[model samples]
Target: MNKTIFITGTSSGIGQATAQYFEAQEWNVIATMRSPEKQNILKNSERMLVLKLDVEKPETFNEVIEKAIAHFGKIDVLLNNAGYGQHGLFEATTSEQIHRQFSVNLFGTMEITRALLPHFRAQKNGSIITITSGVGRVTVPLVSIYAASKFALEGFCESLSFELASQNIQVKIIEPGNIATNFEQTTKSNFAADEALTDYSDYLKKMDEVFKGIYSGGGSTAADVAATIFKAANDESNVLRYVVGSDLQPLIDIRNGGTDEQYMDVLRSTFVPEN
Candidate 1:
C-alpha cells in the first residue's frame, strides 16, 4: 500500500513543496491550508488531495482528519506546518496577539496531533513532522512571541517522541533557518507594535536593520526544507530533531555546545549593540 502524508499550511512555501514532493514519490498527499479554494497549483496532481484546515480552529480538526483518512484509508505521516510569525518587542505585543500566537503555533499544533493519535495508535505506526524555526533554538530580536511558540514546539516534540515511540509512532521536528518564502509579508501582516513608544526608537531601528540583513542574506530555500522534512518522514530510526539549512548547523552547535549563559552571550553579541 502507498503511504499517505497529511500536511497543513500547504498554500505556499515548504508545506506546498513537501506535498508536491510526496505526491511525486507516489504517496497519497493531503495538502491542507486555511483556504483550499486558493490552492490551484497542486489540485490537479495525480495523488494529491487539497483540503481546508485552519490550525487556529480546533473545532475543524476532527472533520479534516476524518476526511483525510476516509479518502486515503490511513495517514502515514502528519506534518504540522500551519503557523505564522508575530513579531515585535514583548511589551509592544498585545494580549490578543500573544494568545493568537500560542493558539496557532503551540496550542493548535498540539490539538491537531491529539486528534490524530487515536488513529495512529490503532494502526500502530505513523510519523509526526512539525515545522519549527531555528529561532526555536537561537533567538533574535523582534520575534519574541514567534520564538517562544517555536521553542515550545521543539520541547513538545522532543518529549512527545519518547512517549509516541512505545506505540510505534515517531515524532520529529524540522528546524529551518530563514527560508525564501512569503512569510516576510505574512510576518508584517501579523505584526503588532506601538509605534508611539519612542523609548525603544533607536533599538527598533537597529533591530529592523538587522532583520533586513538576515532576510536578505538568504539561508535556505523552501525546497531545501521540504527535502529535509522528506528525509525525516522516511527515517525509521528514533531521531527527533532535524535541523535544515547548512547555515543553521554552526549556530545549533554553538547553542548545544555550551551552557545557557554562553548561548545568551553569543545571542547578545550578535543582535545587541554595544553602547
Candidate 2:
C-alpha cells in the first residue's frame, strides 16, 4: 500500500512543493489549504486530494482529517505548514495580532496534531513534521511575535517527541532559513507599522536593512525545504530536529555556543549597530 501524507497550507510555498514532491514520489497526498478552489496543479494527480483547511479554525480540523482518512485509508504523516509570519516591533503589535499569530502558528498546529494523535497511537506509527523557521532557534529584530510563536512550537515539538516515542510516533521540526517565496510579501502584509510612532521608525528602518541584507545574500528555495521535509518524513531514525538552508547554520552555531546575553549582543551589533 502507498504511504499517505496530510499537508496543510498547500496553496503555495513549502507546503505546495512538499505536496507535489510527495505526489511525484507516488505517495498519497492530502493537500489542504484555506481555499482549495484557487489551486489548480495538484488536482491533476489521482493520488493527490486537495481539500480546504483553515488552520486558524479548529472546528474544521476533525472534518478535514476524517475526510482524508476516509479517502486515503490512513495517514502516515502530518505536515504542519499553514502559518503566516506576524512581523513588527513587539510593542507595536496589537493584542489581536498576537493572538492570531499564536493561534495559527502554535495553537493550530497543536490542535491538529492532537486530533491526529489518537489515530497514530492506534496504528503505533506516524510522523508529525512542522515547518518552523530559523528564527525558532535564533531570534532577530522586527519578527518578535513570529519568532516567539515558532520558538514555542520548537519547544513543544521537542518535548512532545519524548512522550510520543513510546508509541512509535515521531515528532520532527524543520528549521529553514529564508526561503524564496511570497513569504516576504506575506510578512510585510501582516506587519504592524506605525508611522506616527517616530521613536521606532529609525530602528525599523535599520531592521529592514538587516532583513534585506539577509535576503540579498540568498538562501534556500521552497523546493529545498520540501526536500528536507520529505527526508524527515521518510527517515526511520529518532531524530527530532532537521535544520535546512546553509545560511542559517552560522546563526544556529552562535546561539548554541553562547549565552543568552552574548547571543543578544551579537544580534544587536549585527542588526542594530547604532543601538
Candidate 3:
C-alpha cells in the first residue's frame, strides 16, 4: 500500500512544493490550506486531496484529520508546515500579533500533533515533521518573536522525539536558513509597526537592510527543502534535526561549533557592527 502524508499550509511555498514532490513520488497526499476554495493549481491532481485547514483554528482540526484518513486509508506522515513569522521590533509588535504568531507557529503544531498522536500511537509507527527555521537555533534582529516561536517548536520536537521513539514514531524538524519564496515577502508586508514610537524609526529602516542581506542574500529554494524533507521522511533514523538551505548552514555551524558568546559576537559583527 502507498504511504500517505498529511500536510498543512499547502497553499504556497514549501508546503505546496512538498505536496507536489510527494505526489510525484507516488505517495498519497493531503494538501491542506486555509482557503481551499481559492486554489485550483492542484485541482486535478491525482492521488492528492486538497482540503481546508487553518491551523490557527484548532476546532476544525479533528474534522480535517478524520477526513484525510478516511480518504487516504491511513496517514504515514504528518507535516506541520503551516506557520508565519511575525516580524518587527518587540515593542512595535502588538500582543495580538504575538498571539497569532505563536498560535499558528507553535500552538497549532502542538495541537495538531496532539490530535494525531492517538492514531500514530495505536499503529506504533509514524513520522511527525515540522518546518522550523535556522533562527530557531540562532537569532537575529527584527525577528525576535518569530525566532522565539521556532525556538519553542525546536525544543518541543526535541523532547517529543524521545517520548515517541519507543513507539517507532519519528519526530523531525527541518531548519532552513532562508528560502527564495514569497514567505519572506508575506512576512515583510504584514509586519506590525508601532508608528507612535518614532524613536526607533531610523533603527527599523537600517534593520530592514540588515535583514535583506542576511536572509535573502543567498538561500535555498522551496524545492530544495522539499527534497530534504523527503529524504528525512524516508531515512527512518533516530536523528531529529535536518538542516536545509546552503546559505543558512554556515551560521548553524557557527552556533554549533562555538560558545554562545562567540556566536553572539559573530552575529553582532555581522548585523550590529560597531561604528
Best by lDDT: 2
Q: Candidates 2 and 3: which is better by lDDT?
A: 2
Query: What TM-score does each of the candidates earn?
Result: 0.96, 0.96, 0.96
Q: lDDT by residue for model 1 over 1-275, one digit each (tens)? A: 89999998889988988988888778999998998787678794558888888988889899989988888899999999989899987888999999999998999899999999999999999999999999998888889999999999999998998899999999989999878888889888867778788888888788888788877888788988888888998999878888888778888898889998898898898688876
Model 3: per-residue Cα lDDT over 190-223, one tens digit each? 7878889898877777787777667647779999
lDDT of 1: 0.88
Model 3 scores a TM of 0.96
RMSD of each: 1.3, 1.3, 1.4
Reference-based TM-score, model 1: 0.96
Q: For candidate 1, which ten residues in a row score worst on lDDT? A: 37-46
Kindly report which residue pairs in candidate 3 clash with one another. none
Worst 10-residue lDDT window for candidate 3 reads 37-46
Off by over 4 Å in 2: none
Model 1 spans > 4 angstroms off: none
- Against the true structure, candidate 3 has what lDDT? 0.89
